[model samples]
Target: MLRHLAVRTRFFDDYLLHAAADGGCHQVVVPAAGLDTRAFRLNWPPNVACYEIDAPEMMAFRERVLAGQAAEPAVARRVPLAADLRGEWTKALLGAGFDPAERSAWLVEGPLIHLEAAESTRLLGEIGDLAAPGSRLALAHGLDPGEAAGPDSEPGSGPGSEPDGDPAGAPRPPGSAPEEDPAAWLTHHGWRATRHDRAAAATSYGRPPGYLTPRLSYLTAERRPPAVAPAVQGRS
Candidate 1:
């Protein structure tokens, strides 16, 4: 299971790195950032800043692990904000110099299933409220093994599928209640979402079959810009 998770994590991390870099975002946030070290590994733009949110103990442990390494962050600034996601996390994030007005990239990885349904909804709401137009969000979750390997798996769809096989509509294993469709949920909150099933994503990442379970899914969404009003013509 750990190996499967690690593989999926690598794929998601690669996607997140490119998405943030290509988008030219000045700020990036990784909530519940447990032990991953993209800030030091990726080739970030000189002007970009990264903020990691995690529990104090986790941050301390990360610091200890990094103290032995000679590597440094590629970005101009990498701030570690220690806070619990369940309580006043936004305040801590803002205090760490987050600018809600600025377009940013947010990565929520490996923590959704731990949250109850209501908690997950609340977390998404907070993120939606904090993000400005043009901001991007990446969400990932570990799934029960064999969940997506059932008969309904779509063939010939790549990880970047747009219309036909949105992961939100993909079939779940028998006896498993369908999850609240994350793409639809995000769309309701004004985000344009695209989902990639694990199989397609694994193929895209050049991993062999059995590298990851089909149950794992990734969704990338962007907050849409507000509509502009048409100007009224003055009487001639």
Candidate 2:
């Protein structure tokens, strides 16, 4: 799931990085950055710096998987930050030399399920506030079949990978309200999003090697100021 979700070109994350590269955004931040090796694999420009933010345990797990491998990153600098996004991640990242004005790109891949609607608002609001005008965000948000519903809607929730000790553990009860309208929420926050359903994405990228799991849905959003859509203005 990790490899299939994070590393595929058809995924918004891949597009996010490509857009950032094209824009010459040197500083990049990845939240809940578990097992992600883009800094080590992608040919980041010499001027760029990459930050990985996640639980300390997740970072340690990645270290174990990458142990004894040539661990040099393609970028000139890489920073590791251990913190919970639901907490004071902004403070932790800033303390670790993250410049809010760095014209950075952010990836919140696989993050919304772990957050509440309010938490999503706070985190993303801060991101939108801090990001330079042209910075980008690539996110994955759970869909409420009721809203973005039509012939394109697909299955969600499964043998739930719920976290045991935390309240986020249990499978979301059957009739609970969705966190928020994924596309509308982001759009109201001045982000223009392009939605991609799971089934379409899997087909576009072909099947994952051995698993056909469709745990992720996508939103490829470019951080913009208010309604100044580059699309309407004929910009890419």
Candidate 3:
């Protein structure tokens, strides 16, 4: 699990940096931001704005830690909004100065697998609605090894049992049905997505593939331009 966490962390770090530096996105949003410190650790581009959203308690804890450490954000602007993802957080985000019209990068890591399918879908839909054309998204999810290996295989362990460790012994949520392909779901929502497995991630990070588990996958997608209606010719 430590290996998986290390690879996943590196993958997202590189992903966000690439999104900011090369993908032409100046706005960064992290939903369920938890105790993440990317705003203080990463070197962002000039004029970039980062918004981190999480539960009120989590936000307070983060602020207290940062304050104790006297940590400063590496970006020009870092806004921390206290809100719940399961609620109307979008309003809070916009109120905190997020610009929906601007191209943005969203990192939805470590939390989706904990949510129910309906909740996850709703969260993704909200993100799609807020994202403008050419926006980028990166997310991670855990897979059911038994499902991946086929029905004949033994029942696999759940995501909460993984080495990464769940917070406060929260019960593991149901696995998303295999038919609900994340890439296809994104495509339907007007985003072009690419899925990556553990092997790919380990290879990219110069790590051995021995730690590769069928338990996790990553996705990176770009929001496509909205479809335009065809114009009708008037009778001459």
The numbered model that scores best in lDDT is 3
lDDT of 3 by residue, 1-236 (tens): 78887888888888898998998888999999998989989878888899999999999999999999999999889999999999999999999888999999999987777787788888998999999999999888555322477534432332212322124322223243322556556766778766666555686667665556545567788999999999999999
> What are the lDDT figures for the candidates, one per model?
0.74, 0.65, 0.78
> What is the descending lDDT order?
3, 1, 2
lDDT of 2 by residue, 115-211 (tens): 8767776778778777876777777665533335543345433221221112332323323322455544555566655555564466556556334
Q: What's the distance in Å from true for residue 218, model 2?
A: 1.0
lDDT, candidate 3, equals: 0.78
Per-candidate clash tally: 0, 0, 0
lDDT for model 1 comes to 0.74
Q: How do the candidates rank by TM-score, highest first?
A: 3, 1, 2
Roughly what TM-score does model 1 have, to 2 decimal places? 0.81
What lDDT score is found at residue 138 in candidate 3?
86
Model 1 per-residue lDDT tens digits across residues 56-104:
9998888888887866888889998888888899999998888999989
Instruction: Provide TM-scores for the models.
Output: 0.81, 0.70, 0.84
